[model samples]
Target: MNQYQRTHETMAAYERLHLAAAEERGGETLAAAWASVVRQWRVVLAAAGVGLVVALVFLAVTPPQYSARALVLIDPKNDFSVRATRAPTDSNTDSANIESQVEILRSDRIVRKVIEAENLVDHPAFRPGVLSQVLSTLKFWDRETPAKTELARMEATTRALQKQVTAKRLGLTYVVELTATMPDPVEAARVVNAYAHAYMDGQLQFREELASRTSKALQERTEELKKQAQNAERAVEELKFSGSLQGENSASARVALKNLESTAQTYRVIHDKFLERYAETLQQQYFTVPDAQIVSAGFPPLNKSYPKTLIVLATALFLSAALGSLLALLLDRRFGGARLKRDHFA
Candidate 1:
């Protein structure tokens, strides 16, 4: 045979001979590889099984959480041509303003007020009736230690409870979304609804204050303008009676009368302008009240928003399997073990 044919024959015969003894573990190298894999299988199965059991225990013991949400709208109720023209510039409806409001809704001032009003720290993880309150008092002992150490500790607890709440912009329609999560669905819904009401009440109080101030200033200025107009008329009448009026000619009475007439006209015009401005001020005072409205209210959620047991269990199982496979591979390599070796089945 030629050199090429001879080389091909030798390779083929070597492969067939290797395949024939593959199942017998006739070679020392193959036997060692099999031994290593068998030794490491025990560690791999044990680690994976332990991990899965721990995961199942944790999933079973974890508490379920529920979430509720509310929505409110903020808009202007006043009618003004100037307001319409400059609404984008003057209004808080812009993206930056919306973001600022979102931040404000999540601010400690609002959040702290909500916590205090709802008495959330002392609330139970069940229904929201009187029985729930009694139950909560019983369980409070188990949950938190009595006698807070410092103001920081109290504040920290308040903030932690507050963190379970969230506020964000729903869209560009001056609407805000409020959400609260708790172990109790009813309590979550009630707290979220209470937060919405509190925010609306705050807005109403602010608007009322602004309206009162505007009304007071307008009243004072209106009175002042009326008095000024009356004074100007009286001065004109007095000048006429005293014969001090002067006209375009050499007569002093004509000239004095003309001057008085001019003064009265100026005063009347100013008085009218003030009256118009006062009316406009009254209209502007209604802006905040009408611009903002509550579009939605929160209710008890039918499902929990977090503490997903199935997902948690699946993740744990996957992670455990992956880690076990990696560890098994490493230990097998170190111990001279292999699985499904080349030509083993053949």
Candidate 2:
């Protein structure tokens, strides 16, 4: 029995005691976790019940909204009766054109037309309440006098209408969807249909105006060319008559006659060209190719578009349960630690 052998025996006994203490503490930890969960069960259920009530109240108070949608198909190739001579660069050009049409659908001019046509100025959705108007006037008093001019009312109505309507281009296609949401299903459908009609009418008017202007220009040029041709023909006839009366077929007279005839021919050729263009422009005026075709007109929706009660209730229930569980665990850690220390002292 040396000093080294005695030290080794002491270390082995200490390791055995430490291992037994760790095993006992692990069992206590599992039991404490189970006790915390059991104590919080009532809190979790109460929180869930409160959440359900709040969701129900919200569903009761909110008004139902109906959505209507109109679909328009844009064919760039057949956009106008007079197609451009230059071809598109690639397929991407078609996408760009479709996007441009989408912007046109959302433009203020088109929306204003729809609003005026539908008489939406007096509609509750398009007109703000008295309180909101007062607030807006107060907020912008320093910018200018708050007089409600026709322009101001129009601007306000346009802004409100813009909020209720939306236009989206279908992905990688020539289709555009114009959607409107309102409290009345009939009004929603009417708004969307108005948008479609207004857009098509605008396109028609634009093309007709363009063709009218072109026709006017061609008509003026044709008149001028006719006069020039008549003058040239008169000059040739006068020269021929003078040569014949003098009985002289001189080289100078022949040259002059040839020059006059050539000028007249040239003028006639130009006049014919102008006449052809004028005729084409007139035909274009009668041409009735639609810029955008209505694939589907808007219809009144059968059901409300918003306030999904079940989804709202389920989300509230899940959030409340998570919050309640977290709070209970925190309280248990705070109080349980204090009790354990007091017991240890005792």
Candidate 3:
């Protein structure tokens, strides 16, 4: 055979051989992918098993939290808010001033008061036994740090408790919800009730403050009016007694007398009217706490709200299995040379 023909035939044979080898490699790649998945099956199972175990342990060790809630109807009549001062309604009720009250309910001042009411700092949950309480009680010993340091520490504990308690607004209604959570059911109930009581007391205090301020302002105004009236009366009397009327022209004298008399009369009328209005305003100033009835009380929760065992365990198991499957697929891909570079030099 000619050299060129032989060379052409050899090239064709090499091309056919290459194609067959490539086909064989592709088949092996698929088999290896399956093998990788099989190899990693044990790992996937182990991960899932470990995840399940951890979830079970968490469920066993963690203690459950108890919750209690109370509902309060905001009184619109008692709610004389600064916003409504420009155009006040005929009657104020609990419902009218709830927005301000809601802010108060969640305030630190209320939280601190509630903590004080329960004496929560000395409780077992806070300090863990009588010894902890005794150390807390030794106030004078820690003179360098200040007694407030201990109080601050106690405050931290109370702050944590406060965070757990919440006051929420009812749906388009004039009701406020006060809720607290504690290990003991009774403590939760007491704390919630105290919050309601404190809110009512605060309302009464607000009214008293308004009344006292208005009274003081009115009294000062009344005194000023009285002084002005006296001055006017003195001027009239002086003009008459001095006999300036006789010395001046007859028409001028008459005019002066009439002017003084008119000035005195105006002042007298103004003083009388102010006195009457001030008296009426004073009579209307009175602060009273509204009677709040509890709509619901918090009770001991029968079940714990945390450490969802079944759900956690199931999630962990699922993720572990999925990871194992992915690892298997990656190994199979590598063996199949899914990523390869052609060699031009060869």
Instruction: Identify the candidate with maximal lDDT.
Output: 2
The pairs that clash in candidate 2 are none
Each model's TM-score, in the order given? 0.67, 0.78, 0.60
Q: How many residue pairs clash in model 1?
A: 17
lDDT of 1 at 292: 50
For model 2, the superposed segments whose C-alpha errors exceed 4 Å read 1-38, 84-90, 129-131, 136-147, 235-263
Instruction: Give the alpha-carbon lDDT of every model.
Output: 0.70, 0.84, 0.69
Query: lDDT, candidate 1, residue 320?
Result: 77
- TM-score order of candidates, best first? 2, 1, 3
Highest TM-score: give the candidate number.
Answer: 2
What lDDT tens digits, residue by residue, belong to model 1 across residues 227-274?
877888898788767644444543867766677778777878877876
State the displacement of the C-alpha of residue 16, model 3, in Å, after optimal TM-score superposition.
Answer: 32
Candidate 2, residues 27-107, lDDT tens digits: the string is: 787677668857877877787888888888888898878899999999877744455334655678878888998998889
Q: Give the TM-score of candidate 1.
A: 0.67
Per-residue error for 56 in candidate 3, Å, reads 2.6
User: Which whole-number lDDT from 0 to 100 does residue 165 have in model 2?
Assistant: 89
